[model samples]
Target: MTRVPFTASCSTSIHKCCLVNTINIGTTSLAAFPNSLALPFVPHTKATSVRRISVVAMSDLSKSTVLVTGAGGRTGQIVYKKLKERSDQFNARGLVRTQESKEKINGDDSVYIGDIRNTETLASPIQGIDALIILTSGVPKMKPGFDPAKGGRPEFYFEDGANPEQVDWIGQKNQIDAAKAAGVKQIVVVGSMGGTNLDHPLNSLGNGNILVWKRKAEQYLADSGIPYTIIRAGGLQDKEGGIRELLVGKDDELLQTETRTIARADVAEVCLQALKFEEAKFKAFDLASKPEGTGEPTKDFKALFSQITTTF
Candidate 1:
């Protein structure tokens, strides 16, 4: 599969089209095509084919300001830099919990220090924001009396410090409330794919119910009556490899796969895409990486999402 580069100078003119093509495997429709496929498929002229083109225009996203929470975390930091680097098309804001983190963002003028657990802290940054991306996740740290060198599980201590109850469930609620009050129209939340399963192994490290709490948070976002996209990512990893082309589907549908790890940078790209993808609004889906040579994902963001039905 070939990877498409996202450049700061990249731009496209939207057009509307209606086209039809039939293959022996199955019939498919192409609503938007840059040019006629007839020239390439002349040898297969016996196959059924239809041709049409429609055009629709989309406004430039460069003027919009996007607010991202948990800016100190891996995924949040990636999203901040990607959006900031494309400042010609997007205004990026990194919402952090500490002055040190604000400094890390290096006086971007878009950095806002705030905590998801406090509603008052969110008031300032959320104002006049066009979109919001929630990347906050409970991190594990070592606790007193725990020694990894001695074969002790320091993860338990870290999990204890990052309580999911206060940060995952309630903190998310606080964010939604603040968004509503501030008149924010769009939101994209990052969640885990196994969040509905309490029996998942990650929960064993923190508690039996960490995923359960995340499910509650997902439910809250669904009912918020705002334009939202909930991307439930598979096991996350931070590696140097490029993003693998992938298949996305309903929760837990892409299980038993070993290549599901997605880079934090790719997840951030999806979050940015969700901001302007009208078809992704009010939709929730799971994402997992596909194996090499799975073929390029022929579907664009809107086309892929239009196939799914959303509850909200």
Candidate 2:
């Protein structure tokens, strides 16, 4: 490791200001930095410095408040439990919609019963939150025996705030807006693959065109100017996580040929891992678990994240 002299200078109207210090890192440069992501990330806010700083990608989860929406849902529940495993680094909070839902969230998480569709309900839950991992969706309640892993179920056949347009698009948009207003440091969205192609099978449920709406929300989050990571997941299975090596790709490339499956628990792990990986910010990728006999799950998130083609 070597120490490099780091200086951040900003100019507004004919005035110039600079903050100078020496930083210890593996690699960085003044020119490459202007487009690079930084951590101990600076939040997007009026008080934040206009100049950008870049560091060799690293994730340090410490003394931050992380709020996970849809905490009562399958994926969110896993994230809620996992975040608590590192209680020294994060204050894990879960947002459910009702008292009944709150009771379903079993953990040391600070549970907030609130609806993502209602902006007013979100304010309190998002306030002072450092990071947000969004797993909420508008998928309609399933019919008995409707296993998403089984391949022929309508994934978004229900409505009443669970519709793709309402929950996936607008509800997610609401969460992004609230994150900005709260001055959140970062956000990670758990979205589905095939959203780039509206004709995908998963979109056929209830004529939902689910992927289309999810793309709208994805675009909104990208344009929201918040540091964001959008994990486009494959079939969300109910199997145990961390068993298979995760396959990660970009632009739905892997989804085009493989209609495979990944566990919801593993998706939660990816979302949690993105919290500290500065490399994942402003990037999106599609992920699915490999076959059962594949091998042990990859433990180095930064190594896996480094393999994705970053579009931002």
Candidate 3:
């Protein structure tokens, strides 16, 4: 997936004032037009005839508060820490569903306890947030009367109160709707790799339709008209891998590949990079590890993304 570049043009003439066009990646561009300063450039580069024009590319996230949902999750914690480390450029806010979870987020003034299922709970943390990162997952333990050990229709448990659809789909809808109402411009979602396929093994575990439900949520996000990036991650592991690299492509295209696991830290880094990339917006892609023999990291995410055309 490639993000479309937005550009603007300006002209200046000699010695009135310096006109600066600040190119902010992943968001709006700021063109400071001067009332008096103008410098006319000559074709020849001479000391007297030459004029200087400086174009500064500023990041859209600088000093902006980003609201991260599921801030107590593994990926959410990493994202929060990374954003906070760049505090000079960003103000990080974490949204948790419980006061306990909020406490787990370490008392950052930016952290707020609120459930995504309640749209009303979203308004406060979402207010003035420039971007949102969604990392919500289903409730951890199996509900009463559902036994993972027995293996007798574990899928039905998803429909019995601990419904994946309610949490994954409706919960996501609530977030999207609240974010939209809050006037948020950018969103990055962390989703599972097999989400586009109902037949995928992971779906079979919770119900043959959990992935389908996730896809439904994806569609809602896509139709929202909000600039978004969806990272469909493969089996998430907490262990460190020898080399860190991301193999990105359109959904459901790269199946039957082993060694697709990626470290959670690398995934967080990719999410951060996506916030700055104009090309990453409005795109949904799957992330997995490259083959062992495929050595060296590639700088071009677009080129890697172009290799696959199919989506779910």
lDDT leader: 2
Give candidates' CA RMSD values in order.
16.8, 12.0, 11.3
Q: Which ten residues in a row have the lowest lDDT in candidate 2?
A: 13-22
Report the lDDT tens digits of candidate 2 across residue range 1-312.
Answer: 223333355334212111223332223323332213343332344533335443322223225789999898888888998888887677889998888888877644489987888899999889978999988887655556667787884434585657888888889999999999999989898888887676887788777777888889988989989999989998899998887888888777776665358998889988888988888888888998787777667788998888887543
Query: Per-residue CA lDDT of candidate 3, range 66-157, in tens?
Result: 88888898888888888888877777899887788777768567899887778888889998787899988674344567766887754334
Clashes of each: 9, 2, 11
Q: How many clashes would you count in candidate 1? A: 9
Whose TM-score is greatest here?
Answer: 2
Candidate 2 clashing pairs, residues 3+ apart or interchain? 59-276, 138-162
Runs in model 3 deviating more than 4 A are 1-61, 140-162, 291-294, 298-312
lDDT of 2 at 298: 72
Write candidate 1's Cα lDDT for 65-143 as tens digits.
7899998887888888888888766778889988898777674668988788888889988887878899887764445
Estimate every model's Cα lDDT from 0 to 1: 0.70, 0.77, 0.70
